[model samples]
Target: MNYQLNINWPDFIKNYWQKRPLLIKQGFTNFIDPISANDLAGLAMEDEVDSRLVSFQNGSWNVTHGPFDSYDQLAKTGWSLLVQAVNHWHYPSTALIAPFRVLSDWRIDDLMVSYSVPAGGVGPHIDQYDVFIIQGLGRRHWRVGEKIALKQHCPHPDLLQVEPFAAIIDKQLEPGDILYIPPGFPHEGYSIETSLNYSVGFRSPTSRELFSSFADYLIANDLGNYHYSDPDIATRDNPAMILPTELTEIQHIMQQLLAQPHIFNHWFGTFISQSRHELDIAPPEPSYTVEQVIQLLCQGNTLYKLNGLRTLNVADQYFVNGEQLISPKLNITAINILCEKQEIHADMLGNALNDKDFMQLVTKLINDGYWYFND
Candidate 1:
C-alpha cells in the first residue's frame, strides 16, 4: 500500500525539522500497512540483512542477532523483532521515504521495520540520527524525552540505552500516525498490542568517522605528500621533550587537509552516496547494447533507479551509488534528472545519446544494476 502523505513541507522544515519532536495524527488517511509481522520475521532470517530480536522478561533483557534459524523459543509477548534497511529489499517500504525528500538527500538513511507484541519494546534509547516512526497495524505508546546529554548504560553488548527521562510528549500512536524525533532525543515505544512500526532514519557522520575515513582516503589516493619541516628549530632543555610549536604545526597540517573544501567535497560526495547497508545490486547477466538502450528510450519507456542506490547532483557532476558521472556535453538541466527524478524520462535523455561518454556511462550503470528500464 502506498501512502499519500499530507505534509506542510515548508512549515515542517521551518518549525519542527531537526529542531524538536512532532506528532502528526493521521498523516496518511485511510492508510494500509505495506508489510506484515511475518514479512519482518522472514527478512530477519536473511544473511545479508541486519536484524535483531530484543526481549525483556522478569527484569532481565535479552538481545540476539540474526540470521535467526528459528524464533520458536522467543516468548509470545515481551519480545520485539527489528529488521534494518527494509527499503533496500521491499519496494513498498521505499515509497515511505519519498515524502521526506524535502530534507537533504545525502542525509537520508534506510527504513527499519519492527514488530512487537503487547508491552514489548527496546529500552529507552537515544539515536544520533533523526527518525520518523510511522505507526502501522496496531497501537504503540511512545514517549520522547528532552534532547540533552543523558546517562547511558549497556545491559548487553549490543544494546545501549539511557535511564528513563521525563517525556516532553507522551501519546498512544495509532495506525497512520507519525512521530518525528530529532537527534539526541531519548525516546521509547512500547506496544499496546501486536503492532508494526516503520522508522525512516537519517544519518550524519561523526567527527571520528570523518577523520578516519579522510585518513583512509588520503592513504588510498597517496595524497598529502608534503613533509613537515620547521626552518626555525626550537631549542629545548631536554632533547626528548617535544616543543609546543611542533605540536601546533602537526595540528595545522591536519587542519589544512580538512580545510581543502574541494577535496572534502569529492570524498564526501562518494562516501554519502554509498549505503552503510548492503544494496540490491547484481549487474545484468547479458549486457544491453547502447543501441538497445537508445531504442528503449526512443520507445518512450522510463528508466527507474535501483532501490537503495544513492544519487547526488553537485553542480555539473552526478554521483551515482559511489562513482562520479561528469555531466554530458549538455548543460546541468539535462543531467539534473539523474538525481532529481527516480525515473529518468525519455525527454530528459535529449542529445546525450550522441556523446559516447554519456552512452557508455549509461550502459555501464544499467549493467551494474544501478538503473533499469521500466519495462
Candidate 2:
C-alpha cells in the first residue's frame, strides 16, 4: 500500500487548505483497497475497536454502536459500517497514511474506514477537523459545500446534521478518487454502489482541549503553586478587594509556567503523542527475553512499530506511549529512526546496535507492546 498523491503540496496548502474543498480525480492511480469489507467487519467485532452502524430507513436515521453481534438484521441497503482508527488494527491500511505525513504526524488523527451499501450515507454533516476521503471499492456520489453559517439539528442523538447547502463540488467519485473537505464545511456522501471509503482525518485540538491537558499536567507535576504573598503590604481601602497589582502578579505566576519553552514543549510532546483511541496492544504471551530480542535484531530481523503507537521527540528527548524516555543511553540516530519510521530492521541499526543501552531500550519497548519482532 505504498501511496503517492499527484498534487503540489505547497500550492495545495497555500490555496486550498482549509479555504475550500477540492475534488482530485484519480488521486491515487489505480487504487486498491488495503483491507476488504469482510476484514473490516471482523475488526469491528473486536471489543477494543470503536465502530458504528448507521442506517436510514423510510425517513428515519438510526445510529447503533458496536461491537455489534450481527449486521444480519440491518437493511440490505441504506446502511454503512464505520470503524474508527482502522490503522491501529489493520497493517495494510497504515501504509496508506504515508503520503499524508506532510500534515505533521501529531496532527493526523486516524484512518476511519467505512463500508457502505447503495443509498447509504451518514447524512450531510459538518466536522471540526479537516479530512481527505479516498474512494475505494466502488462509486460514491459526494457533494461538498463551502463553509457557511447553517442551522443544525440532531436527527439521531449521535448525529448532528446540517441543512443542505448549495454544493460547490458535486460528482460521482470512482475508485482512487479523493475529496478533500476542510473543517466547518457542510458535506455529504451517497453510496452509488457497495463501497469502502478511507478517510484520513486531521486533529485540530481546541483551546479547551489544550487547557484541559495543560491543567492536568500542572496538577500532576505540582507546578505553579507559588503562594500569593504580598511582599509589600499596601494600605488598601477595602481588604476584601484584591488590588490590580496583586491580580497581575498572580497571573504572572501562571504565565511564568508557560514562559519557559522547555517545560511546555516537554509537556506538549508527551500530550500530543498519545493515541486518543484504544490501541491494539498485545504484549507477547510469554514475553521475549532481552537476549532473544537483541539476537533477533542482530540477525537482521525487523522491529515493527505497532499501529497508533505515538513515538516522537522534542529537542533531545524521546517519547513513546506518552512517557518521555530520558536516558544517557539514548542517542540521536536511534531516536530519529524510532520517531520517523514504522519499522526498524537490522540494517537500520547503524551505530545504535553497538550500544548495549540502546538495544535494551528497544527490548523494553517490544515487551511493552509498542513494537514487536518476528522470530
Candidate 3:
C-alpha cells in the first residue's frame, strides 16, 4: 500500500492529470494481490454483488449474469468477468484501492476487478472516469489513443466502439504494471494470458450531473426556497408551451444554487459518503440500548469504530452515510486519521464518546452496522 509517486505530484495534477492520460511504469512493484481469483469468484456468488460476464463469440459480443460456476469453461477464448465495488464486499480486495490515496481520498471511486481469458477484451471504448488498470497475474496488451470526436467513433449496443486509430502508446503490461487512462480517451486491452486486472477509478461528475445532485441536496436540506418566476408577462395560445423568459428564470435559479458558499463541498461529501447500494454488514446479534452502549464506552469494555465506512471532514463538519455531524471541539486530526486509517485505535474513541449526543450517535451507528465495537 506504500505508493511512491515518481513524477512530481503537484505538477502532474496542475498539468496532465485529466487533461490527458499517462501510463506509469511499474507503479506498484512486487505488489501481491490480497485476494485470489477463487476468492473473487466466491464474492461474485453473493446476491448483493454486482457482476457480469462478457464474452466475444462468433465475432460478436455476448454478456451473461454472474455468480459464475467457474472460469474454466471460458478460459480458452475471449471472455471476461467484471465485478464492481469489490472493496465494499471483500476486505482483502480493498487493499487494491489503497495506493490511489496519494490523490484526494474523496475523489477515489470503487475498485473494479476483471478476470479475463486469453485474448479477451471488451473492445475500444471511452470511459467517463479516470482509471488505473493494474495487471495482476498475466499480460495484457493495451492500445490507447487521444480523445476524438464521437461522430468519428462507431457505437455498438453493448459496447461503445471507436474506429481503429494508431495507438499513441502500445505496450504489454505485466504483473505489477499499471496503465492510467483519463476520461474521454479511446482505449482497449486484450489479455495475452488468463489474467486479472484491477481498475482503480476516480470520480468525475458531469456538469449536468453536478447541478442535478446539488439541486437534490438543496431539496433534501430544505434550502434554496426561491420559486421560479418571470416578471415579464407573456401569453401564448397554447398554455402548455413554455416561454423563453421562464426558461431564463430556471437557468438563473440553477446558477444561484451553484453560487452558494461551501455548497460543492457539502454536496460532494454527502454524495460520496452515501452508498449507491447498501453495503454488506453484519450487525451485532443482540443490540444494546443507547444508554448501555454509552456505559460500555465509559467503562472501557469495548472500542467503537466506523465499520467499512469512509467519512469526510469538511469545514469543521463530519459527514458519513449522508448525515452531517458538526463540532468545533471534535479533533480534526482524529477525524482525518479515522477517515484514512482503516481502524480506529482504542484511545481515540474516548473523547468522541464523552458528549452524550455523540455517544448516542455512535450507538446508533453501531446498531445500523455503520460502526462496531468488540467486547
Model 3 lDDT on a 0 to 1 scale: 0.74
Lowest summed lDDT across 10 adjacent residues in model 1 is found at 326-335
Top candidate when judged by TM-score against the true structure: 2
Candidate 1 residue lDDT tens string, 202-320: 98899899888888888887889879999999888899999889999999988888789777777777777778899878777688988888888888888888887788865445788
**What's the distance in Å from true for residue 202, model 3?**
1.0
Per-residue lDDT of model 3, residues 1-375, tens digit only:
444434567876787788877777777778676667788788788788888888888787877777666665764688888888888877666667765778876678788888888988888888888998988888899999978775434333556677777789899999888888889888999999989999988877687876788878888888888877666678799999997778888888878867765786787778767765447776787886878876765666654344336677666567886777554355555556555566555466657656655556556667877666656
How well does candidate 2 match the true structure in TM-score terms? 0.96
Global fold similarity of model 1 (TM-score): 0.92
lDDT of each: 0.85, 0.88, 0.74
Which candidate number maximizes lDDT?
2
Model 2 misplacement above 4 A:
233-243
lDDT tens digits by residue: candidate 2, 70-161: 77887779989999999999999998888999978888989999999999999999999999999999999999887889999999999999
Candidate 2: residue 363 Cα off by (Å) = 0.7
Q: Against the true structure, what is each candidate's TM-score?
A: 0.92, 0.96, 0.83
